[model samples]
Target chain A: MESTQATNHVSYLQHKPHKIGILNWILSTDHKRIGLLYLYSIMVFFIVAAFLGLLMRIEKFAPGETIMDAQTYNGVFTVHGIIMIFIIVIPGLAAVFGNFFLPILIGAKDVAFPKLNLFSWYIYIAGAILALISQFASGGAPDTGWTFYVPYSADSSTNVIWALTAAFILGFSSILTGLNFIVTIHRLRAPGMSWFRMPLFPWSIYATSWIQVLATPIVGITLLMVIAERTLNIGFFDPALGGDPILFQHLFWIYSHPAVYIMILPAMGVVTEIFPTFSQKPIFGYSAIALSSVAIAAVGYFVWGHHMFTTGISYWSRWFFSFLTFIVAVPSAIKVFNWISTMYGGSIDLKPPLLWAIGFIFLFMIGGLTGLVLGALATNVHVHDTTFVVAHFHYIIFGGMGFAFFAGLHYWFPKMFGKMYNIKLANISFIITFIGFNVLYFPLFIIGLQGMPRRYFDYFPEYQYGHVISTIGAFILIIGIFIMLFNFFRGARKGEIAPANPWKGVTLDWQIESPPTLLNFDEIPVITEKPYTFKKEEEA
Target chain B: MEDKKHHISSFNSLLMVLIGLFIMTGISVMITEIHFSTFSVGVALLLASIKGYLVLTYFMHLKYDEPIFRIMVFLILLLFAIVIGITFIDYLLR
Candidate 1:
């Protein structure tokens, strides 16, 4: 395997542009640097949101006003949801991993529009700052849940406008990043690396980019409508002002639901890359996995109505959405089956990345299956606003996407930083995090099923047992997260240097130096084979 | 460096498209004056979509571009139509 020193390649980290110091990172247009900028920024936001989440869990320990008052609890969860959804997970995998690796995986020098890519990160920061301002500005943090549902959002006296504007700006950033990825993938693939020959990560990014471009505008316009309603009293969603509140729901979910696919497809793509490398086998049903990403994105658009089942949408609309929801699950299940099959009968490495991938499947299955329970018209009405929905969402987003992010980070950490992390520590952190995650969320399912409503600061005494257990689980999860982060930090500073292909993978990324040089390849090599051709390696 | 020739619309062709867009806008305004009751919003959307089509075809050069661009545009329009059509299912039933 090749090493960066062996190739005399200057890593993107070492290469400095015209700008010196911090400006080199914040001002540079190199995709890798921009990706690290996103990674660092997202980590900051994730910690903030996770802390807010921990506060919420602690408050739930004994129910009524354990740590904070009702209003404060509302503000905490609202900000938590906003930070996690818009700032972290939605852009998490794609912005951080996709920007860093997409060009390398596809054998390109950089994304087609590097400057626009940097601009997206700046817009993201501006939006994030606005969100922070919303929290501490004149009025208290907007109590409107991250959904910022109608009538209440329109009437709320809090700094709702700032939050809405922040979301709108963030959505715009998402759209631009998506646009850049689409063009890069379309125009810049290596000579012989056709669509089919491209790896799953880029394919997933391609699908996610399309969703970001197409679906995000709907949310942007919808949020602006909310802003207009709040500021100008435009009567877009206020029923008293002759606006239909349900219309707001329709527009919001039109984008937000597809936005879910935008979050998960790349996660699915990340695990797909990991399974093949660790298992030392070609990905099973390569075309199926690739096409499933697009299929999920396409089908994801029409199923937004499932969210409105109890919003009193028409029966036929509910039925249509319910049916489409079930259909969307099919493509997701296909990807899962293919991943497991990829690992079947192969030389499994059982590395930390693989452990996270396997954990993703376990957690995502729970999230996905419970999603069907929520999708069914009969069952959805029962748990519409219950803690059950909360559990399901966390299992999917936090358990699924969050775990997949860790998997990709561990898998590519060496390649990205040219340093290998502590393998034993990495594995231990995954175990703690996995167990803690399940413990934190699992009880919510039980209590949610028992009729405990979500978003309330206080709950009945009967639900106390579940909340206490869940809060304990929250602490455990946080400990695991810190350990994993510390391990990465320590490894980056003082660990053994990584080989170019530590896992003996056949993908183009592994074929390059550990930390790739500026403009990636010395010369663009023509690819003439499938992306994951590990048969030769297996024979050897 | 490049082999594919860029398609530049003729001056007359561009002017004709501009006139057509203006006429459509005028019709859109005129249609609003005579309300079709429940069909009013539908009529307005139809007119707006026609204007959008003209802009995309002539101004955006989708008409002269490769088939893939046109196909992608068509698919997007179809998706938008489906979303709107599905939303109406609730209102119409209610």
Candidate 2:
């Protein structure tokens, strides 16, 4: 497979058609370049949002008005949630890794719709810029929070409209990306790469694309309704105009709950790739993991009501949602079981990527279990809107998706950049990040159970202890992230050249050059075996 | 890539589908005059679903496409129905 391809072809990085300096990247229709474009832009937004999160943590260190007023605090957290959710995590793995690797993994030269792939990035940037503008615009940042619940959002003096419009536009970007992936996966597979023969990452992307395509429009229209309620006084959610606010919650969570799956499924897919490669073994249950991705997406749709369990929805509705929420966990748990079982009998190489992959499983398990605590109707009422819910969310989003993003980045860094980051530095950074992340979020659970609410600018002195520990953890976590990123930056610039197959793994991406050429392969290879095929001879 | 044969619908087939849609629209508007109380919205939705099925099957050419596509469409409709039904659980129970 390696000997059949051209060895001297120019990498996509130095490929020449778009000769303009910056325009070479921004205007390029290449999927790999477009994937990097998403990577760079998402990194920028992640830094901004992480800074905002750090600021909020700082303010919470001391009980009363540590740095900013309550209004400013509201604005900070709102912007943080908006950027992190919309710009960073939702498109995090799929946009960056899926775009870059999905085609190569499936033995295609590029995605089915390459131009549309680039167009999605442009739309994403447009939406991201609009979100940033909402912060600096005339009326001040939106205080409605990211959810933009009605009545307050409809009547808020702040720039809620800008935020709403930004979210709506971002939803369009999501839909387009999803649409592109669906077409690409459907149409662009290599000759013999049957459905089951394709890797788990593409399978996860396929499932996530469905959620993105079908679920995003609901949020798009829901956001538009809020805009209309504000601008036209149409009263879609305003009680004064005979609208139901609970209905808004329903519409929002209908998409938003499935949106959680959108965020995590790709992360799951990333780790699925990492676990098998690092363990040097066949995946435990290929069909189960692949089908579980689809199951999570499908069942993820009906579990939105769990988020609204405390919102005065009917008892039966609450019960139904709770039951479905628990049911959704089964597929996720199946995935976790499969991951752990893959590592059980294999000769495991615990490198930086594997460490992060292991970290993802640990943290995601905590996140998933706590999610069950919240899924239970009785327990949810106890912790609803508390820091406990906040902790659960960060664990899932940051611990699950965020950690998996880092794991994928490290795993594919050599392949993507043809450079090897310092292994010691990456390992140290992961340790710091793992410790800091838990330190930052775990206390919130304790304090939340002790009766501390979330999104509040101040807290009682009793809660100050937890807040201080959590803030310290935030600083440590931020330092670790910067170090990890800096290591990658240095590696990309001046590191040892990486081999085609750094981990000696069996996958199409690994079989190709370190940094793939303009067109990924000289010829699309026909797949004749399942992904993650490990033999004893190769292990030796 | 596998070569796929494009299915082109004929003018008479398209015209018949259009006429069927128009007749359904007229019936939909006329049915508003006499409706069962709680089932009015249900009736309207059922008619709309039929029209949608017609559009998807003929106009959208699902009838001519692969069986997998039809399965996907059916699954999506099932999902849509389940979501709507669950949402109604809240409203009706309330």
Candidate 3:
């Protein structure tokens, strides 16, 4: 603390000049360090899950039990979904970049409860470890899928209890982080930084944290009930004991649907920041874009029932859910248009970060439109559990949220590490990843409509071409990811020294030193102007 | 000063909220005494909302807090109501 003692010039990378080393990271409460900690940990899980996904794709390449057995294939995708959903993507953006940039953006030193922030990371790791342990627990890995649906989960011989309990604990980690962000945003903005004047990223985070706080608990309770049913022979979801399976689904999705927003809203926030910063213009319709995050979160809850339309819900319920699902498109579409408008006629800087953000918009629009397809009662019945649904989810979760995470990572890389990555290589990686992603998922849309079902170890000869194409795309995509990560690692060590405000932006973060000091601002910045004031300064 | 005005501190207000909660609890039990099965759940929920309102207002100081806080709490409750109501639309329609 002494070495970092309120110096204006020292970046956070130089905190504790002569003190305890890794303990400063694992045990420290600094928000910047906590964000990097999440970055390192989540990336490790991302690679692991990506490999799992590749294996699943390989098995599907030529159908007919290529390598793994049906049971192993089932277990692989389940664990893959668990690791990707619970460990990596769900908490990815908010935990990593949000933790890193939020305090600096708001002109605060750290989160309101700094120690609680560190505690949540530990909880996340503990839950992740438990999920790994569940893979080897009694009766092998869980095959109930990430949704962990009804009587099967209750009666399965696989380690459903461990998986559910791990998910339940992971919910706590998410809740605490959400609670921390909400409080920090509410109570910690620096002098003169009113709500509307706050940057779009933090505004979206404010929305995400609310969903995390309110929606995560529902999944926690539902998972606990699943554990209770598995262990105690309770008939909560089992038809043998006269319980309705539909209720379990309702409870699961009530949280899971909102949990989807928790995944994407921060990603949208990252895109919001990236667009203007890259385009060298003030954000278009800033207020509408900021409020739409809240609108998406608000509308997210009412439409969970859409996921259940094919499950024999009543006719009226289906219609109600279908209408609400389409309604979510409005706010989401507004954000897409706003991002494009931000880019229009501006001094467009097509950096790696901006490219990824642009990529996110294109991919996410496809995902959202496909989602409306699946939301309708008519089309949903045609592709309910097919590879089409799988492709749709990946495009949204992997393509949308995942690319946005990469965009944030690239955008903040210099600011984060105080080093500039190889720009040429970064651009090349983005193009390949974009092409590979489209090649990987677009074929599934065709085959899925042709009715090739998902989660099977082997497929029919008819679906082989699509499977082969998707598998080849995954490899190319993985290769691009490798080069991008290599550039980041190489940049961190021996790359060009980055100056403060590399992007030449007007956010409070750019006002401070790059790789910001132990406490974010040496002198807490006064918000003299609205955020994203590009060509002109506001009257203070 | 503006925030100070938004917050409540009077012992009288707290005591009055306590009395209202007690009355709501009585009504909640008395409503069960009326014994129409369908109406019982609705009546109990209405009384409970009143009790919850008292707790949130005086006991928890939401009434004293900013309008933003009130809006947030209302939004949360409204979300839950939509979820529950829309979920039941299926079985109710069937």
Which residue pairs clash within candidate 2?
Answer: none
Q: Please give the distance, in angstroms, between residue A387's alpha carbon in candidate 1 and its true position after superposition.
A: 0.6
lDDT of 2 by residue, B1-94 (tens): 3446678899999999999999999999999899588787699999999999999999999999999999989988888888878887788998
lDDT at A127, model 1: 98
From the highest lDDT down, the ranking of the candidates is: 2, 1, 3
Report per-candidate TM-score of chain A alone.
0.98, 0.99, 0.97
Off by over 4 Å in 2: A3-6, A538-540, B1-54
Question: Which regions in candidate 3 have their CA more than 4 angstroms from the true location?
Answer: A1-8, A536-540, B1-71
Off by over 4 Å in 1: A1-5, A535-540, B1-4, B10-34
For residue A490, model 2's alpha carbon misses the true position, in angstroms, by 0.6
**Which TM-score value belongs to model 2?**
0.94
Q: Evaluated with TM-score, which candidate comes out highest?
A: 1
Q: For every model shown, what is its TM-score relative to the native structure?
A: 0.97, 0.94, 0.91
RMSD of 3: 4.1
lDDT of 2 by residue, A68-172 (tens): 999999999999999999999999999999999999999999998888888888889999999999999999999988889877888899999899999999998
Give the Cα error of residue A432 in candidate 2, in Å. Answer: 1.1
Q: What would the per-residue lDDT of candidate 1 be over residues B1-94, giving only the tens digit for each residue?
A: 1445578789999999899999998998777789698898798898899889889999999988889889999999898888888887789997
| Interface DockQ of candidate 3 | 0.64
